[model samples]
Target: MKTIDQTQQEIVEEFSMFSDWMDKYEYIIDMGKNLEQLPDDFKKDEFLIPGCQSRVWLVPEFRDDKVFFKTDSDAIITKGIACLIVRIFNGRTKEEISKSKLFFIEKIGLVQNLSPTRANGLASMVDKIYRYVK
Candidate 1:
């Protein structure tokens, strides 16, 4: 299996191919479209991410000392962003996730392109993912 850093690097490379923010945004929406849907049972109020302009549900599972994430979002771009995070962090150890830095976010220019509300929502998503390990 690829390491989280390797996956992140791959994502960065993928995003780097796009010359404009519009293409990047479209790709993000596509990525979100492909993310596995979270189950209805897990989409409770408790699972909802706070501070998001759109509803996002993230659930974590610990199996065989590895962490896995399942996520869904109401907003297309946000869902795609969440999917990117889940792709990187899923199957990693809690220690790896807790210690890792998400340099890809800035490298891909995702934060700068995002509206402030969306950016805050992204932060909240990351925070919630970290909370899952705690």
Candidate 2:
């Protein structure tokens, strides 16, 4: 799997090539398609992400100074969002994640698009990652 840094650079490069939000959104959705599906048991309440419109689960593991994340969501769009995060934070060290300028909503181009609740959920997801990183 590609590291978060690599994914971020790729995203930025991709965005640089595109001149519109629609292209960015399409790229994001394409990235989401590649995310591996989460196991049924992994999507339980204990793994549920708060503040999200759909059920989302992110299971993180630490190894060799890097974080590995596996995520899944009940909503297709949210699943895409989760995938975006995993692609941007997975396989990164705590320091790397901490320094990351993920811009969860902005990078995904959700700044003025997603509902207020979904935006909150996006924030919650990033918070969850930071919490685990610590």
Listed per model in order, the count of residue pairs whose N, CA or C atoms clash below 3 Å is 0, 0
Q: For this target, which candidate reaches the highest TM-score against the unseen true structure?
A: 1
Candidate 1: clashing pairs of residues = none
Q: Model 2 segments beyond 4 Å from truth?
A: 1-6, 104-108, 113-120
Task: List, residue by residue over 26-119, the lDDT tens digit for candidate 1.
Answer: 9999998988788899999987888787888888888999998889988888899888998999999988888888778888997653344653
Off by over 4 Å in 1: 113-119
TM-score of each: 0.90, 0.78
Strongest candidate by lDDT: 1
Instruction: Write the residue-wise lDDT of candidate 2 on 1-134 in tens digits.
Output: 66556686676676677678787777767766767888787877877888786777888888898899899876766777777677788778898888767644565456653444654476677788988877
RMSD of each: 2.0, 3.0
Compared with the true structure, all predictions reach lDDT values of 0.84, 0.74
